[model samples]
Target: MTSMNHNQRRGRVVIGVDTHKHIHVAVALDDFGGVLGKEKFTADTAGYGQLIDWSMTHGHLLTFAIEGTGSYGAGLTAAVRRRDIGVVEVMRTDRRDRRLRGKSDFLDAENAARAVLAGHADAVPKTADGLVEMIRTIKVAKDVAVKARTSAMISLKAVLVNAPAPLREQLQPLSKMALIHRCAGLRPGSMTTVEAATKHTLRSIARRWEQLNDEITAHEKMLAELTTTLAPQLCAAFGVGADTAAEMLIVAGDNPERVRSEPAWARLCGVAPIPASSGMTTRHRLNRGGHRQANAALYRTVIVRMQHHEPTKSYVARRTAEGKTKAEIIRCLKRLLAREIWSLMRPLRINPQTVESAA
Candidate 1:
C-alpha cells in the first residue's frame, strides 16, 4: 500500500496559473485530478523559479495551463517554455461557472489546471520573440504614425479653412501635396496678427505631417524587407502587399503550426462562415468573431483580387452569373485566400525546437 501510494505521488502533474501584473497564483493537480498544492509567487524571474520549484514538489510537471499567455502570463510562459515544458493558453473561465462557484485567484488557477486536464484549452500561444514580433512592433509604430500624420493633415486643412481671406484663398487653390509643401515653407515672423498665427499653425502641422510621413515610409520599407525575407512565397502571392502580409503574419504569430489547419486559418481571420441553420433553414453566415485585423486584411486582398487578378475575376464572374451576391462571393473568396495563405506560410514556419535550442 505504501509503495502504491509512493508511485501515485510520482505521477505527472499539471500546474495552472492565474497571472497578474505583480503576482501570479498557481495550483498543482495530480494526473488523477486531485489537488496537490496551491502557491503564489512574484511576477519576476526569481518568482518564476520559486513557482516551478513548488510545482515540482507535487510530482513530475506535465504542463502549465495559464491565463493571458500573451499579456500578463507572458513572462512565466516563456520561462516554462525555456525549460521545454508544455504550456497551454487557457481562455477565461465561463462567466456562468464563475458566478456559480464564486471567484478568487486560487480558484481561477485551479480552474485553469482542470481545464487542461479536461482537454478544454489547447491553444499554443504565440512565441513573440522573432522576426514576426519585430514586424508587429514596427507596424504598431507605423500605424500610429500614419494616423497622426492624417490628423495633422486634417488639422492643417481645418486651419486653412478659417484663415484670413488672402491666406485661405492662397492655400485652398493648391492640391493637398502642394498645400502641404507651401505650408511647410511658410515663415511666421510673429504672433502679432491673425495671418501670422494662422501661418504658424499651418507650418507646425505641415512639418509634423512631413515628419510622420517620413517615419511611415521608413517603417514600411523595413516591414517589406522583413516580411519578404520571412515569407517570400506569401509576399509573392496575389493581392498581398507589405501591410496586408504583416497583418496576416501577426495573426499567425511566429508559430504557424498553432493554426492547425486551413479551416482554422480561415476561422482565425474571421472569414470562415458560421452556421446559422435552424431546422429547415440551412445556411452559413459570415463569422463575426476571431481577429478583426486579419479579417480586414483578407477583405482587402479579396477586393484587390476582384479588381485585378484574372483568376479571381473569372471566379467572381462565374459566381455572379450563378446568382451569388457580391457579399457571398467575397466571403467565399476570403476563405479561399485563407487556404492559399495557410499553404504558403506552412513551409516557412520556423521550428520551435530549433528556436528553443538557440535560446
Candidate 2:
C-alpha cells in the first residue's frame, strides 16, 4: 500500500514534441519506454503551458526531446529552458523507420522520446535568446540584401546585352559603375518604343540595385557593430571580417560551452577531417557535414590570409614546398583557423543557468 504509492510517485517521464506552424503534437513516455500518453497543443504561449502541465501529470518531467529546435521547436525550447528543464534536440525520425511503420505526428513525437530514452538524442538545442541570435537575424537580412543586389546587377547586365544596337554600343564602353549611374539617370517618358521600354527597364533594375546595395551596406554595418561587441577578439583576428565572424558566432550559438572543445568547434564548422583509412592505406577525407556556411567563412578567411597575412603566406609557401596540393593546404588552414576562432570566442561563452536565474 504505502510502498506501491511511493513507487508510483518516483516514476520518471520524458516528453517528445513534433512541432508545426500552428500546432504541436507531443508524446509522454515513461523511463522504460512505455507510452504514457499523447496530446496536441496549439503552438502558442497558452498551448506550451498546457503541454508542460499535462506532462507533469505523468510523472517527473525529465526532459523534452524535440525536433526542429532551431525552427518550429524554438519557442517551446525557450519556454522549457525558462522553467529550468532540460531540452535535447532530436533529429527527425529515420526514413527506414518511417518506411517500416508509416508515419504520423504521434509517431514522430514517440520516436523523439524513444531517441532520448535510447541515449541517441543528446544534443542541447541552441538557446537562441541572446546576442548571438541578434547577430544571426542581422546576418540573414544582410545575406538576402546582398543576394538581391547581385541579382539586380545580373539583370541589368543581361538587359545591356540585348538592348538596341546603339544603346549597347554606347553603354558597352562605360565602366560598370559609370553604366549603372548613367542608366539610373535615364528618363523613358512614355515607353512607346522598344528603345524607350529598354531604357525604363534598365533604369528600374539600376535603381533596385542601388537600393539593395544601400540596404546591404546598412546590414553589414550593424553586423560589424554587433559582432564586435559580442566577440572583440574574433573581430580583431587577422583575416576575420564582420561577415565571417558573424557566421562563426552563429555556428557557436548563444551558449558556446555547449560546443565542448576546440576540436568540436572545428567539427561543427565541417572543416574537420574524417577517417577514411584501410588496413594498409591510412588517410582521412574532408568532412561533408556540420555547418557549411561556417566552413565557407573559414575558407574565405584563409584566402584573405594567404594573400595578405605574412605568417599565413609563409605557411602556404612552406606547405606548397612540401608538396601539399592547394586544396589540401586550404583544408589545413581552415582547421587551424577554426581552432584559433574557437579559442578567441571560448572566453566569451555565456552561462545559460546564470542568465536564466538572473531573468
* lDDT of all predictions: 0.89, 0.89
Error of 2 at 194 (Å): 1.1
Per-candidate total of colliding backbone pairs? 0, 0
lDDT per residue as tens, model 1, 1-359: 67446745677789999999999999999888899889899999999989987876676657899999989999999999987889999998999999999999999999999999999989999888887888899999999998999899888888888999999988898998999899999999978999999999999999999899999999999999988878888999988999999999899887878878788888889988889999989988888999999999989999999999999999999999999999989989989998899888876564532233334
Q: For residues 147-190, what per-residue lDDT tens digits would candidate 2 score against the true structure?
A: 88889988999999999999889998998889889999999888
Q: Please identify model 1 stretches exceeding 4 Å from their true place.
A: 1-10, 350-359
Off by over 4 Å in 2: 1-8, 350-359
**Which candidate number has the best TM-score?**
2
TM-score against truth, every candidate: 0.92, 0.94
lDDT over C-alpha atoms for residue 82 of model 1: 88
| Candidate 2 clashes between residue pairs 3 or more apart in a chain or in different chains | none
